[model samples]
Target chain A: MQINLALAQIATKLGDVQSNLEKHLDLIEQAKARKADLLVFPELSLTGYVLQDLVATVAHKPTEDDPVFKHLLKASHDLDLVVGFVDEDSRHRFYIASAYLSGGRTLHVHHKVYLPTYGLFDEGRFFAWGDSVRSFDTRFGRVGMLICEDFWHASPPYLLWLDGADIMLFSSASPGRGLNDKEKLESARWVERVTKAYASMFTSFVAHSNRVGYEDGLLFWGGAVAYDPNGELIAQGPYFEEALTVASLDLNQLRRTRARLPLLRDERTNLVQKELDRILSK
Target chain B: MKIDLSINTNLARTILTAFIKSEITRADYSRAVINLSGGLDSALSLALTVEALGAENVLALRLPYRTSSPDSLEHAQLLVDQFKVRSETIDITPMVDPLFERDPQMSKTRKGNLMARARMIVLYDQSEVFKGLAVGTSNKTEILLGYSTQWGDSASAINPIGDLYKTQVRQLSQALGVPQPIIDKAPSADLWEGQTDEGELGFTYAEVDQLLYLLVDERYSPQECVEAGFDAKFVDVVVKRVRRSQFKRMQPPIAKLSNRTVGYDFLYLRDWGT
Candidate 1:
């Protein structure tokens, strides 16, 4: 199977939700025009970075019957749209989430697991940490979604890979400042290397998208990239600027890659489970 | 002319003490590290830290640039001598010159900021080595006027003096018996030749502190500020600075999916225990 994917590197302005949504709509149209089967956006593409107190003021709920969700569903008809948002749950805690829009409806929302609360990041001060790892079935294959800090921890993506996810999508609004851009690139490289290395053993692909712009005092450097099952860079975007980059992946290649490197066939889950239990135990 | 005013020393001490205690508990910090600049703000913050965490738990770092005034060093030494606490001196000139040589076009403001950040880098490095927290010394006056640099002097693991006005800092410093020279000397960033805080800010420390007290502490509007005898121009300057520097006070916005954030989320420092 051949899959065409478009990653939108939208430049976001702080606290400008309406303008950001308009930009997202325009990019969705652009992705459609490029004849892409799947489109991914940066984290929080609707509200921009550093919304500060405006998050409390601007964040809205998206119920099954909400117009915003309905609008996105209509736009994403026949295409798989993965976009980030700040959603208010029933418990009233805000979550940094990404919603999967396909078949003219909201399919699922994945909340960020690891909330960074040190240095320039204060996610712990904002959103609640999600407890679940979600993977959905698509026409292309079984796909998994993870937010920025989710990929930093080994457990989430590792579980997704083990659970038969053929592809992983990462969305991030990682800040671009000082050495952050370099860190972001290095992090993306690590994700690609680790996930695709796993993918080569198990056969999967990974798509990573990040945002770009000056929001408040922070800068978001967009360096979107993707890797094939063999950990080869199939597509790479520019740093510190916005651009939509697309790539084509063949599922047959993934199968062949896994056939050559059959490390997953070696049964070692029992040993690994013991080690994990020891580490996670109180 | 004695104006009718309420001066609750207990209330003031309680507010400062509560803020310090809460800040430490929130960050899970056991100790604090501060730069004793021999200025009122630093002196007040040092005193507060010592009062809240004891002298044994607080470490004072006296960082002097090559061109720092002799009086500044004297006052810093005076504080250490009075408190009988451990203090160390690290000259930042050597660390900052190479960067300046490479980027000669760096402005005085930029150089000052680099010096501030370099000093903080040392303080934080020491904090890691000592297992302590870096306490900030910026006063509310400076925060209101955008007088500090982001990630430079403005960066800290915690700030005990950020909400206090400059005049309040002086009063607290005197109450804490910080040396007279530190309290008396004109405020300066000591970034370059012939530089003073008032010269750059276009207002005296006394005037700015008074205006800020009436405006920010009292929550006076701009018109009310002018009617209270503050120059409209000065009020406008401070208000504009506060508005422009509002970004420094917040976390970078992540797209909200959950309901509670620092700005949007309703979690309090007290909630950490729960």
Candidate 2:
């Protein structure tokens, strides 16, 4: 089976949910017109990033009664959607999360596990850390989702791979930073390298989308991209601009790539679990 | 222990241009006002503002005091002519000399600060009338060294070149086609006739920039910088300057008497709702 993926690299207004939702709906219509099977938006698509005090104001539950997700869920009845937002639990704790919606229902929600506190990020002070990393069944295949800093660490994607996720969706509102003689933003170069490495190592299709435009002084570089299971670049969007790039993924390539290089086949999870248990017990 | 400060000029130019455009547009303003000092930093900043918000949109004001170098005005004109930006030459001597005359025994530093603040007053006034943002021209080296006046030349709505070091600023000014003389000339506060930045600071920009790159960007300790082959005395001076000037780089702290003070817990981005 083949799946068409749309990378919605968009700029979000700071602390504005209504405007961002309207933009999402407009993009969903365009993605549907392009016949995309799944449209993935950058992290905090509904509520913009850098929400220091406004995180509580914009946080919403991914329920049918929620103002933002209701429209998104209705839109997803026609096409699968992965949208990032501030998720508030019943206890009123907010977490940076992404939800996968299909067939007018929410399939899964992944809270961003790593809240970067150092340097320009203040996520640790604003939101709760998530402790879950699991994959869920989609109409096409088992899919896993992770927000910006979650994919930077190897464990989240590794857990998803072990949970039989054939497709990994990553989204970020990553700022354009670190300029050197390499003629590319260091952040952009580093992200592409890591995503491609994940696709080849895990033998899973990877699609990553980043937002564009500026908030305060930070500029988000938009360069949505995808890699096949063979670690080949399948599609790329423009940098420093808003775009909705579509790529056709031939899921059969996963079988071919795994057959050629059987790293996943020769794994020893039991030995790894025993080693971790010993290290922790000590 | 050698540091490579070389950057991709093309990438820097593209990013800085986008920064000016996005920041100005975010504030719902389509124009920018720059006090072009006829120096390398302001020349480069004007070029970027022109590129970002067209030549006609940027208003370049050449604010000169009575003793300001004639070459400064000419150098500033070169950029105004090169970029075809709208310009106004305002003599700040009238506004600033009253204070200088009030205190005949005033120090050169005091005079320089007064002049800087005077220019800022005009720039901001024009910002309201022209409905543009005041773009800053301070570089990282000066900012880190506390070589700038607090709330004077350092004041700005948004700064595109604040992160670049002085060495990086020269590199970018060349790439952006700022006149060669401006980039090569000795930097000065021009408070006195022969006031060169290096002469006052007692070290060359190239020498301090390397140490600063290690200290600030690479997060090297003063001891580590000495280990990395920098002079201990020079490291002490730079580190102390950076430490002493900490108050200049940050907003004034608010007293935390309530649950959510403005700067402490009531955290919000500058572009909070816009």
Candidate 3:
């Protein structure tokens, strides 16, 4: 099977929910024109990153049949949307979450498990850590979702693979850091290395969508990329610019890679479970 | 691997135009105000400002003291005429001299700081009158060396040229069509007569900028910088100055008695959108 995916590496105005909602509608149309089956946007693509208390201003229950997601719900009839938004619970707790929307409904919402608290990130102050991780069935395959910081940990991807994820979608707002000899951004290199390794290791395709444009002094590097099941970079986006990157994912290759490696079939789930239980018990 | 630190002028032009316009318009200000010093740095900023907000919406103010070089005023006029921006000239000698007169034993360093701060006061007051934000012109090399007055020239609503090093500043200035004479002239803060910036610091900007890129941007250690062809003494001095001036780069530290401190926990600027 073949599916088209578009990475929406777009810039968002901070705390402007109304305009951001409109922007999503417009980009969705552009992706639809490209005949994309799925479109993935960066983390906090709706309200933007580093919002501080302004996160509250844009936080809304996307599941409540609110008007915010009305147009997006209407647009999801033809494709699936993995979008990042500030989610507010009925109890008033906030989470930096990615909502998997298909056929005019939210299939699943994955909150960011790892909230980066140190050095340049203060997300712990504004959001509660998500304690759950699981892969959900989609038209393409069983898919797992991870926000920016959660993908940095080795555990989430491994666990997601164990849960039967054939594809991992990473929504990120990673800031550009340092410079290489070619003047390429350091964070861009780091993202590609980690994503490609995870793809080859688990025999799963990884798609990372990072935002671009400046927020105060922080510049989010757009270099969104997609990797094949064999860990080869299939498509690359530009840096420091808004780009709609489209790539084709082949399911036959996904099967072949897993069949050849059999890394998942060789797993000892019981032993790993016992070890994790022991560690958690302490 | 050696990185080419030169900027892509076309991309720089587009990004800076978008940045200035978006940042200013998002803050509900349609106009921009800048201190035009007739130097390469300010000239580049002024050109970008004109492109972003249009020459009509941009204001160029020349704040000169009695000791300021005549070339400074003349070069500033080149930009004002080149862009056809709204212009003003304010003599700052009258404003800062009263304070300097009271302290007959004041050092040149003290007097420079006072003048730097006095100029900021005039620019800010014009900002209120003109209803525009004060755009900054300091370059990254000066910021890294703490070579600027703390609450003076460094104070601005927005800074466009702060990220570019002195080397990149010269490069961008040339791309932006800055006058060749200004770019080639010896850099100075004009704190006193015949005082050049490199002479006062005892180091050339070209030498320091290359060393700084290796040390800070590439994560090279002082020893690595020396190995990369910078003099050991130069690396040591730059490292010490950067470390010594860390306070100037940050907000004042708030004691963490409570669970949330001002600078640490509640770190948002006051003018956040509602």
Candidate 4:
């Protein structure tokens, strides 16, 4: 299946969800005009990253008939949309989540499985960790979702592959932290390298959407990108600017690359699960 | 791992301006106030701030002591008029002299520190009155060498030129159209009547910039820096200064006894989501 994808890079305001919603709407319209099959936004695109105590204030449910969700649901009538949002569940537990809206409805919601809590990250303090890694059906094919730091773990892609995902979508708020834009920064070439490597390893099309703009002192360099199943770069966006990187992905190529490598076919899932259970239980 | 020390001056100017603009506006402030000392760093910072926030939104404070050079005030006034930004010339001699007079044992060094702190007090006080943020002027070389008066000139709401080395500061200052007199003149803290920074520091910024590039940016060891044509003793001296002044670069390290110590665990961004 041939599909046109747009990775929308935007600068989100930290607490002003209503103002950010306006930005998202404008970008969504731009993507639609460009004839993009799917438009993917950065992690927490509705509310900026580094929320600290504002996470609770900005967190909202996708089920609510809020104006932001209403606008997205209206816009999703024509184009497929994948957007990151701070989700507040029925129990009032908050999660860093992405909602996949297709055909005017919320099809799938993926909470972030990993919450980074080290230097320059404090996600674990506010949001609860997700427990599942699964793929859902889409118009293009089966697609899996991963949040920013979740891509750091090798297991999520492998699990998504086992779950039969043809496309892996990543939403990131990665900051450009270092000297050289080419090598040292987190938003540097290393991100592209890892993104491509993951695509080839899983034999799935990978779309990475990162945001740009400075918040407080941290600067996020927008280097949104996507790669083909063959680990070839299909489209890449600029650094430190708001842009939409569009790409064409042929789903049939996933089968061709998987046939070439056959890593997914000869995998030992049961043994791996048993080993993980033993190691984790101890 | 050869690193290019050369920066695209135009791109550097654009990026720094964007950074300053975003940092100030994102924190919900529309204005920036920088202490213009008639030096390369302060002038460059003021130019960038004016570009970022527009001349009307920028405020340049000229805080000078009684012993300060007349040429310094003239240079600062030239920049203020050139930029067409809001400016105020405050004499810090009155606030600092009473404390000095109370103690005859107070040395010039202590008096200098008092003047620097007094300037910061005025900047912060005006920051509240004008509803603007304090932009810093210290360059990377001085920050690394601990050449600044701590909690004095170092205290600012944000700093744009702090990451730029002294050599880069000069290049950028020229690129940003800083006055030639300020750019050409020897750097000085002007604590006393005729004190120059190079005269007291025993080295020039140009030489130290290259040494710091080799030592810090390139990750060259002191021995490697010596081999790369820096004097062995100078390399050792610069390395020791950078090492011992690490505290100046970071927030005071709190002992990790609590579940959430201030700088240890409570190291979260302030003015977030406002």
TM-score of the A chain in candidate 1?
A: 0.90
Q: What is the per-candidate TM-score for chain B?
A: 0.88, 0.98, 0.96, 0.96
* Residue pairs that clash (backbone atoms under 3 angstroms), model 4: none
- The reply for model 2, stretches above 4 Å from the true place, is none
Model 1 error, position B148 (Å):
9.5
All models, DockQ values? 0.02, 0.84, 0.24, 0.32
By TM-score, the best candidate is 2
TM-scores for the candidates: 0.52, 0.99, 0.83, 0.80
True contacts kept of 1: 0.00
Q: What ranges in model 4 sit over 4 Å off?
A: A64-75, A88-93, A181-186, A200-203, A252-282, B1-12, B27-29, B74-90, B94-99, B102-104, B121-132, B140-146, B165-186, B198-268
Clash number for model 3?
0
- lDDT tens digits by residue: candidate 3, A1-282: 999999999888778878878888888999999999999999988888888978777887666377787767777888999889999888888999999889988888999999999877889988988888899998888999999889999999998999989999999999875532334656777888899999988888999999987787667888889999899988999988899999899889987887888878898889999999999999
Candidate 2 C-alpha lDDT tens digits along A1-282 = 888999999989999999999999999999999999999999999989999989999998888998788999999999999999999898989999999999999999999999999898999999999999999999989999999899999999999999999999999999888887786899999999999999999989999999998888898999999999999999999998889999999999998998999979987889989999999999
RMSD of 1: 21.5
Docking class of 4: acceptable
TM-score of chain A of each: 0.90, 0.99, 0.96, 0.95
Q: What local lDDT does model 2 show for residue A1? A: 89
As for DockQ, the candidate ahead, 2 or 4, is 2
**Top candidate by lDDT:** 2
lDDT tens readout by residue for model 4, A1-282? 788999999988777899888998999889988889999999999998888767778887665387679888888888999988999888998999999998788889999999999875878888899989899999888899999888888888778888988899998998765553233353466677788998887777998999988787677888888898888999999878899888988878987887788878888888998999999999
lDDT of 2 at B21: 93
RMSD of each: 21.5, 1.0, 4.1, 4.7
